[model samples]
Target: MAATHDVTNQVPDLVGHDVAHDPALLESLHRHGAGWAEAELRELGVHAGSAKAQERGRLANENPPNLHTHDRVGHRIDEVEFHPSWHELMEVAVSRGLHAAPWRDERPGAHLARASKLHVWGQVEAGHTCPISMTYAAVPALRHSPELAATYESLLASTRYDPGLGVPAGKSGLIAGMSMTEKQGGSDVRANTTEATPTDSGGHVLVGHKWFTSAPMSDMFLTLAQAPGGLSCFLVPRVLPDGNRNPIRLQRLKNKLGNRSNASAEIEYDGALGWLVGDEGRGVRTIIEMVNNTRLDCVIGAASGMRAGAVRAVHHARHRAAFGSALVDQPLMRNVLADLVVESDAATTIAMRLAAAADRVDDPQEQALRRLGLAVTKYWVCKRGPAHAAEAVECLGGNGYVEDSGMPRVYREAPLLGIWEGSGNVAALDVLRAMAKQPDSVEALFTEIAPVEGADSRLDRAVSEVKKELADFTDAEYRARRVVERMALVLQGAGLVRHGHEAVADAFCASRLEGDGGLAFGTLPVGTDTESIIERARARF
Candidate 1:
């Protein structure tokens, strides 16, 4: 043989694995009362994480949505065309009730179950989750007015996914989008200049520009505009009842860093016929419900990305050899992989627990927890995603940086979650606002974590510090990030201690609560059981 090369140490394929049946995911689901749906979840997971699904994800990203502004005859026809793979993914998502399953079922663990499904599918392709999340979140806000709810609830709740554009009454199933940001008012809707002039038919006509309108293919959008009464929420349909295009015109699609499979656009409304959904001038109050649900999905999407990263990193390390040993067997690599595992688990734990609280809508305590817990979890988990993806990419070394490896795509997708629903500062300020306005939220969070009070001394100290920090409201907005991070840490500590493995919990409390960690991933204390933690996280795959 002239020159023999060895390929024996190459990592085995990670595709075709059942994401929902993964031990870590299963553990989290069971802990959060969603285990009852394990059988169905496992089937979905197998397909979602399968090699075929991977190919679909790749093709979808490789070919982004194309905007069509006019017809062949020069007629104004605003439409977006996506690759077939995008439609395939949407079909799977909608047929499974991944969009509005909780609202449709109204069972004990409906929201938790829907959250689990979203987590599983998101790992396969996160871009499609945007429209799914929007449709899911729109249900509650649509209910703000019985008339609006009665018109769209059943269509939204339907498992059918129809991508066609026409009159809403002609469609069997529907998707919803949102446009709240304007050129001047980024997040402050009060600064919006979109004029909502009352029409003779008791409807409103919107005339203004929306800087960001995601999922332009949606049949309707929940948008904010300045009504004569003040800032108000409106249901702006893409097509009028006459089956003609509404005055909503697509300006252009955004050139985003990621989420290419979904179309995010800039549009203008010139006399776009709309109906008020809630009390005029109460736009923020009405749309806040939708924003909250989407925020929870952000947490889920971030955690799902973390889980995917951890799985790929650990799986690669387990089989790939270097310097006469598998990478996973090396002490330094083990520490890094284990730390990623802890981060993923903590994120998953908090997201699932919040979902469970959302499911328990009948309970007052759970309601309070949902109010505060959403902001806290969304801020910490989403903020940590980009960092986590970076570390996971490093674990695969040069191979991870390539687009074909899928790591770069995930890395790009990470920041969108932080930006969407709400940015980090926005979430942090929301947490503070919740505390100042609804003190009961804080007490509910305390009650939620009280079960693990003495489970770990470090956790106890962390809890005490957070309570002390909350006592002084001076410059609270400036200190909001620190306060929210601490709340997230304590919540994770308690959750891990109660539901996660002791080794994992101890590592989290030691590194996060006790301040033993550095400013990066893989900074867990040397004495931590790195091997056991990595093995547990990897065993799921």
Candidate 2:
């Protein structure tokens, strides 16, 4: 999170999915991906000739563009900035961190190294660090990179970094916002004490130290500050200009619990320059869009952790030995293995569905649902999924804890989700708030997925009973834990379906056809496997 340190390596491009093609995806995002249930943003009047807008547009494409290359070398400086005449660059970094490969890669060094650096150094970053903050930077670039749609998401995990930083083209253009918890905030946002004051220099100055800034050393920051009107956000930059030259200060980084790769920081601004995001007191809502991204990302990151862990467990289980038998051969172990498979699939499905929904969610109300779904998913997976890894560890006995085994690493990264972002309590409140705002629509959402989660079946009859309990409850607060638990199961099931292995929805439908095997295809009216499995299970019963 410092400035003036030497950076020698070029970040690696993300390793999966080609994001530059597929116009068909945008159409789908509007339907199921973004989910249009939320109210719409009334488009503001278009000013074709507004000089300020024109200047912004013109500069947005100017040379040296808006990439914050200094962050690469900003890891060692510790000076205060006081100049007031710096020019704003019309550019931002376009890299997506958690969703991108090399960073999200879960390998030995790259991801761990980057995340740890951010953890320890993020405080003085002078930029954004968390997944949610990164999405702020991606929005502008997406304006010009329409072709990057289908491929530009880390929404499942956390918009913790800029998408322009993801893959294919992640070298430049990054911007960040600091929406870490306020003092009255969860994960400690409530403890925030940053203030924005009108200065004699005519530019505002921000003075505060926040606990969690997702990315700390980028060029620009969208920061939250307290004022007479209440909480407001400001566009703060890391620059000090004396007359015509600009200089910046890199402050401090946080030592985080898990995502040792993405840098989360605690920052202090001593009269750093800032511009209000909207009107006075309007700063809080202006950046909710950023938090919404984080909510969805929490789901994605957790799900990704589940998948990575499952894959490793699956691989290890196949080769491991137990009591002179292959570990996978034991019936009890198979159940554990199946549990791993099922949960991983469920987690992935939830993230992908929400990711698709996020792409099209223009309405705040509707986005609230997507947000709740994602938070619940992330919270549950990040919280419970690690136990599955531990189960695999038990399957491996002591070897699982060995850092070299890959199991320990996944275990390490998985738990961080619950602590970072909003954490479970924060996410639960977020979902509760969403449910409270649109009780009926929220109920409808619950009803819509209940059958999917608990299909008319022999196995899920109990799950159906739980859904009924959710439906009968009128108070979101009353049903908070119950609702979250059920929704976790719902998303857990959905996550299973989005699997690279095949979906869980089909698997549930397949259960109707083939009870215990967990099939991938829907039941056919003609029923071949359905009929046979019915007979086989009937014989057992």
Candidate 3:
């Protein structure tokens, strides 16, 4: 008799379900009071979570973008060609108004709704998000110059997603890019060598090279150049009004570790025509609006990674059997999965809370929360993403190491968030800066934590410890990481208590706040209600 190969009980890939139907995400949206937009979010989640979306994500990454510097006739076209999957992803996001909904819709939960949409799409494909993020962030900064806003605001906020390269006057929609850092100064814009000369038309012409130009295919860019007054912000277009290409020449594309579907370029400007967005010397102040908005996205992106990782791991474990039982049923595996649930929940809750704060325009407390709390959450949440993804990978054992399993891509995407907008040290320094320069921000942090002041003793103690650290000014800069860590832990702990499941909240406070867990993921205290946590957070598909 021929020996037969057995193929029984192998777990299938997780797909064909709406991410909006995710119990954790839905609970988070409603718990954070964003249910009003649930119908729209649910539709987006269905598309993003579909098998087609998953295949598109894979196709886009598998076929990275190609740069075509010139036309067949040797004319300088400077175009970047992307796979159809990339365009499909962008169309899905843009048609849903993910790029401009918050600024365009003057509703109570506009930001919350928009954030949910972006978070869901990030899980599907993150590379297409770069330009979308820049376009959404450019609004506030452009408003600094009413002329610039009047010229571009409506175009930027249009629901149509135009990939055409030309002057904005002819486009149905628009996207923006940012070029701030130079080789000499990675994060220090003040050290840039790019120069901008005043033009007769009240604008300026820029001549400089940007070391890292994100989404180089964008129709417009918000960049900084050294003007006569000082470093200033400028709006550089890909094509001038005459339908001719600008002097922006593509240097080459950066070979990034991840985000391969997105094109990041190094380019030189040869008298590139640009318009000033604000006062000549106030470039940093104006551009900071864009930076802050992107920072918020960085935070949400990390949270989405955490959620995807956890859900994928839990789904695999539920179907894969070991020792004559499901891996998820085992005691130690249960602890690991549940711990991930807690971490994922904490990340999502805080992100949505920040979005809620963003929508409350008249609330000074929300403004303070935006100023200080955003940095803290960005630092901690983004910093946690890699470890969280690694833990989820380990739960899948050998399968997770392979590319088809999807865990590897998730892991690669994790570090970009913490590094983008600002590195870990930069985020920590900003947290300290907010505390010193804006005392009200510190007060806002306390106000957010007050709801759970007495609910959990562990949370209370963590808050007290953070307060003491804040009070002591000795070597604060040197201890910024530690200070910021405590602040993050306190905020996450309190946030869980207020908005998360009791078992999940208890596990988080016990493991994260009281230090019951070891120095890594899956080290939750032994007595955690692992099954309940997993059931709530496991991927339904």
Candidate 4:
């Protein structure tokens, strides 16, 4: 090889490191009462950062799922074929209990433990988590129907990945999907035209189309349709109890911009059998539990992406050089890296806090806080993901724009979280709705922030601003985003002040809450402790 061909300046491959070595994440895990799972978290983190797992992630996306609507014999099969690596990734996720296991676990902080693992392992691949999240979320919704929950809850929570077309009763474990959005309805699920006619067997026959049914290969789906009473939620199985295919038809797979490894299809339920989930005409109320849980995962997913991007940016800067100095040593690069770290830390802190709320279902305050906190956090955190990812990519210069750097995948996956569960407007208005309907949620948010009332003046002022915004509902719908953004920042600032590292909390308060920073990332104020902030975000071997 020629001397010119030497790869002297290139950064080494990031592998064999603990992805869970994050300070904010670990601290929150212990503080939230899941300290016992630290060893397992670290072990999973090692695998998440391994070269083999990285390759699997890459391959799963590179070879996206293929839809086969029919068999060679002209029979309807409606199967989505994926690369072997997809199954490999799903197997690891299921075996580690990242899905529905938390709902059934008797231990405290089980949800927090699951959230921690999802945040860590999600870095390997974001697409596979789609089905995993749905499966985890489906449990709560299933509990709405006692008989159905009794039949499927245990299998859904089982740590076995059984991938095939089979009756739910025969499968060792199950994956679940949600089919709510229709062509005309989108976010307004009440506009759905799917029809569900009651049958004598205590089931309903669904006849309609779902515009976006993610993870179509799952064994079951929770969908919405209009019955005789009104719009209602129903559980539709892929294979019926008598070992026959349900009448659900695969229209075609969506050509999505990202999350390619997960198959989202436009499915037609042609007289598919379904069991009612809740009271008639209360479809939204019944499925809202699943939506909330998945929304929490959306926040966790965004935070995971931010962490991945920040750590990769830091790793690149530490090795790659420019102008006779390592990129990490450069002042401006330090500012950018530290700002990214601050954002990542803030997101991680809030995400863990929400998961802690999930663990305390019996506590009204925690539940109320989660009701309002999840909405605003989901809106702001996910809304910030794309910009955060873009800045992280730029930290790697030209290398990050390319496919192999893995930054492109991170960048692409960012926007999907904001869109999933609910879009920005939907989430923002949901906060307002929660305040109006569940007023306790409003007080709960303030109570959560009260602990750090005078800890940071900037945070205090931000909190006051949020209170004022809430007071004046004049065009509140129009100003929903603004109100929600401030709410999210105050909540994040409070969490950081209460639990995050000193440098992290200070940076977040200064830039995010006080508006001391510029529009883009890397614009933190001059006195910010860039080094300490960036150090905490670096991956450890």
Best by lDDT: 4
Which residue ranges in model 3 land beyond 4 Å of their true spot?
A: 1-4
The clash numbers for all candidates, in the given order, read 0, 74, 0, 0
TM-score quality measure for candidate 2: 0.61
Error of 1 at 258 (Å): 1.1
- How does each model score on lDDT? 0.90, 0.44, 0.88, 0.95
Off by over 4 Å in 2: 1-76, 79-133, 136-172, 177-179, 182-191, 199-203, 240-252, 362-368, 450-455, 458-479, 491-541
TM-score of each: 0.98, 0.61, 0.98, 0.99
* Candidates ranked by lDDT: 4, 1, 3, 2
Question: Candidate 2 lDDT, tens digit per residue, 98-176?
Answer: 2232223343232222221222112111122343335433343232323322333233223232222122223133344
Cα lDDT tens digits for candidate 1, 1-541:
7768866666677787778755556786677677788888988988987888889998999999999999999988889999999999999999999999889895578888888899999988899999999999999999999988998899998998888877897798999999999989788778999999999998998999999999999999999999988999999999998988898999999999999899999999988999998899999999999999999999999999999899889988987989998899998899899999999988988888888888888898999999999999999999999999999999999989988778998899999999997799999999988988999999999998899888789999999999999999989988899999999999888989988888889999989988656877878897999877887656344
- Lowest lDDT sum, 10 consecutive residues, model 2, at 37-46
Give the Cα RMSD of candidate 2.
Answer: 15.2
Predicted candidate 3 versus true structure: per-residue lDDT over 1-541, tens digit per residue? 8769978767898887677765656676776677888999888888877899999999999999888889899988778899999888888888888888777888678888898888888999888898888998999999999988998889888888889687887899989899999999999889999999998888898998899998898889999999999999999999988898889999889999998889999999988999998999899999999999899899889989998998898898999999989999888888889888888888988888888888887999999988998999999999999999999999988899998998889988999999999999999999988988999999999999998878999988999999999999899999999999999989888888887789989998988888555887778886788888998766645
For model 3, how big is the CA root-mean-square deviation? Answer: 1.2
| Candidate 1 TM-score versus the reference | 0.98
Clashing residue pairs for model 4:
none
Model 1 root-mean-square deviation: 1.4
Ten-residue stretch with the least lDDT total in model 4: 1-10
- When sorted by TM-score, best at the front, the candidate numbers are 4, 3, 1, 2
